[model samples]
Target: MPSIAPDGKPESPGKVEVQPVAKDNEIRKRIADILITTSWFGEPRVAVQEGIVFLKGTTENDEFKQWAGDLAKNTEGVVAVVNQIEVAPATIWDFDPTFQELNDLARGFVRLLPMIVVALIVITISWILARLTVYLLRRGLLARSLSHLLREVMARTGGMLVMLAGLYLVLRIAGLTQLALTVVGGTGLIGLVLGIAFREITENFLASLFLSLQQPFREGDLVEVAGVTGYVQRLTSRTTVLMTLDGNQVQVPNSTVFKSTIRNFTSNPNRRDDFIVGIGYDDSIPFAQEVALKVLAEHPAVLSEPEPLVLVESLGPSTVNLRVYFWLDGGQHSWLKVKSSVIRLVKRAFQDSGISLPDEAREVTFPHGVPVRMIEDEGAVESATAKPTAEPETVATKAEASLQSEAEEIKEQARRSWTPGENLLTLSSSTDDS
Candidate 1:
């Protein structure tokens, strides 16, 4: 029978017989022959014993050393590889790998050039859309009733949303979908932290928005709110400014102003004022009431339609206390001046009518007989007790000028010191008749 080769093909009669197992020398020679074909730091020595190959060499880098070891291990009949290959120390002139890495990076960037250009175009379009959104929002009906600050906030918010959408698309085009999601989520997280950190400021801002919408008080309107009584000057996002009665500026937080009760004095042109006047108990209450009413009725600033009232409030130890109530045009006259003038005229009228205002009576009981003292100044005593003989001079009774001038001055000062847009109220409310 003809001998068959390992491939199960019948061998030719002239072919030499082949051995099934390779010799150690043959394995070593095979690896050495392959090594000579490539460039290396130095020629290495290769040895094999019982099919185990041993390699020893020096190479310029670990990659070359690893390549030599792998070459030996893949050789025919190799059982194990003991690679004692050493990599040469780097020299200052060795920059081949670094240059190769840079070249590869440059090639990759060139490959992504088209994507980068598209991203830039997307960003530009997004920017234009953002600006257009802002313009449209500002001119929309939604902004008509909004305050300047609120309008700006809304417009900017709308624009930012557009820009964010553009950013997301750009990030996706750049193949950074995960990064885009992180950016969006991080923005919301940062906003939440800021809101919590500035809780009071956020509250004030929201309150200001509501106040601007509601318009509880307008600029130049006399108002009392948050324990402050003043003329409203301006309303900012954080605070509500007022010029107090003493002509001092006060800034109350919008949150406090919104939560507190607001008393608008200028809302109604007519206001009522009252004061207590005490007269001697022997004087007839009806006559004193008539005299006081006459004084208020005769005053030019006093409003007669409301009809002034004089009621017996209480009886004191030595006098009868009367409560006098009267109305006046608050828009044209200062209430302080009107009340002061009315008091003065009423006192004069009482004196002219002989309505005695007596002091509180005090009684003293002497355990011993009252000590008598002889008075040598009889003429002085008589003069002190004598009533005035001249006729009572007429007293002037009129409301002084209103505080509108002072408020205007304050408003002027605010205009000089602050921006006109800071004022969230219209001038119509200040100039309109109540």
Candidate 2:
């Protein structure tokens, strides 16, 4: 008979074998050996059927049970493995319960109860003091006419400082100094992150503070900010609110307001109104200016002290442009109404003086001498062909009368909605927006 090796292969012709070729029992034995060697998995019974391994046992934990099956599956000659192992249910011995443990926990709570109560009391006192301090500061600042925004900043900063002090004391009293330090350190990091994320908000807030301190335009002031002209309704930490002439609310960022040009119309009681009058090139320039100044001076709303100015500004294609400048009491009369009055009065004065205001003229030429027929208005025809002795009525007088009637109508309409009162500064109730 030929000798066989452990792997079931025939040995060399002259070699002697000490053990028969590996069999099912040997493979099973090898798997069992591996499982027993693993200390994490308590003894799991192993059986091999048709070169397949089945594990059956309970371990201290699922990890150990899983390890037993995995170990069998990895062994040589094991086609497959079925892990039927389960974890042993926890027993009372695991907790080793005793009244002493409960008694120790209760005693610990009792020992710390007094310190906890003291800490809470300290925090409460601190909060009350902080609020009182803020209230007092607000009253004092408001009395001093300090900006509302400045007052809020000072009060909040003071309150936060006081609160921080209180918190530190509480932590110390409760023997949490390490925790207090951790919180303090973390606060800086949190603030850094928030500052980076909300840079625009921070910039606007700072700009608002600067604006409040500078006092560029107060509430209710008519101002032109960044080309937006309106009445300042409110000033918040981030935005400046305006009630536009169109009756819409506009919120402009404080940063933009601070950076852009601000025209404060309400700052001055007097404002100048300017308009251009174009007269026919053939008209008298000096006569036109004289008539304009006279018309401006005669108007009740125009200021006499400054004296109205009329200068030949430029010569246009069809006329000589006269720029008329006049001063008015802006506080008493609406700028628009005053300007409209000036234009009407100037137009009438020019007509009465026979200084013709020019209009655009177009002359079209025919290429082959085409005959042209001119049509005139019926009113113009009646005026041209009327009797020379018909009261000698001047068209200027009729035009002036029509203008006066229209002015009275406008005045009546304005009176319906207008109330007599001086424009006062709008005071904001609070400024703690940031």
Candidate 3:
């Protein structure tokens, strides 16, 4: 019908003819062509009416049906797609040819049986060689000086590497080179991940190895490390064990023990002992010094090689502070016991020599009107210069002598106590002996 002209008369439509539009059938044919050419699409029936594509037919699977429908939906001039394609169910015919295929596969494997047997033989030989390599490295290559635990670990690691190499060769002989490469690549990736996760463990392990080589402190040695003082009980790959003086066990990480400052008391048998004595400022300094020096020199535990020293270190408000220094054989006796004895002996000498170890004194000033009361004890008061009832030697000598006897007994017990495990050098000697 021509459009109505604005003038009441039917306007003559311009001599124009509408070209015929392409029909849905042509679009359907193009969509079918596209579906047929797609590899994933099986036989899917296609129909089109009014530019809407309808898919219907049986395919091998749902994937083919989906792919055919998608191609139809994207076809030019397609309005919509209705997918009703069904997937075919397997029938006895599907298994008809599998028997022949299996037979062929068996024949092929039979033909390759000799190669398989040879590969297995190679693998078995490789395994045997790996074990032999481990034995040789453990008994010959590794130094006896190495810790036994470390030596074993290194030997096993070398064996594992050899075994892996053998496995790679077997895989290659079996025409499985791609599989071997895949395994190797995967192993490298897994190792990277584990190394990152166990970084601290690896650090402590390496630190322990270095410490073993350094031998800073041996088992049974008394050491101070990372603010802990104790006798070293054992050393392992990860930690150093210490038995404290109170008999409690402490486990320190090897990294901390290696990095921190360590004080090995038993490294040297001799150590210096120090004590401060306050004497009256009015007393003769020279006399006080001479008496303290003589007491230290006479003590049996004190070392005579390094002469005992007495120095006036500082002056307090009331008395003079004299610092007494003496060298004692730490291994022979307890340092604390000897120092206690020296203090007692010096105090008695001061009293006998009439040199006062004075207390700090201060004059308390009060307001002008304040009254002060003096309190006195009911007990008898002994004068500072009173003569001794017993001999000065008897009073000063008794306490130290008793302590020394007890300390000697303790020292004997400690000496008799033996610990387990061997240091690196000891292990080396034992290996040689065996």
Q: Which lDDT value does model 2 have at 420?
A: 27
The candidate, 1 or 3, that scores higher on TM-score is: 1
Q: Give lDDT tens digits, candidate 2, residues 85-114.
A: 778855666553467688888999999898
lDDT of 3: 0.74
lDDT of 1 by residue, 1-434 (tens): 22446864333323222256678877777677766666563768898999788888777777667767766666667789899988886688989889999999999999999999999999999999999999998889352655677777889899999999999999988989999999899889988999899999999998988997788887778899988998888888888988787867889999999999999988887899999999997898999999999998888888898999999999888889999999987777777887877888888889889999987554567999899866679898898779886533343333444323244565566556543336666533443433
Structure candidate 1, residue pairs in collision:
none
Off by over 4 Å in 3: 1-115, 141-143, 171-192, 199-204, 361-434
Q: Pick the candidate with the highest TM-score.
A: 1
Worst 10 residues of 3 by lDDT: 10-19
Candidate that beats the other on TM-score, 2 or 3, i.e. the better one? 3
TM-score against truth, every candidate: 0.71, 0.56, 0.64
Q: Write the per-residue lDDT of candidate 3 for residues 188-223, one digit (tens) a residue.
A: 898789878999898788887788777787666778
Q: By the TM-score metric, which is better: model 1 or model 2?
A: 1
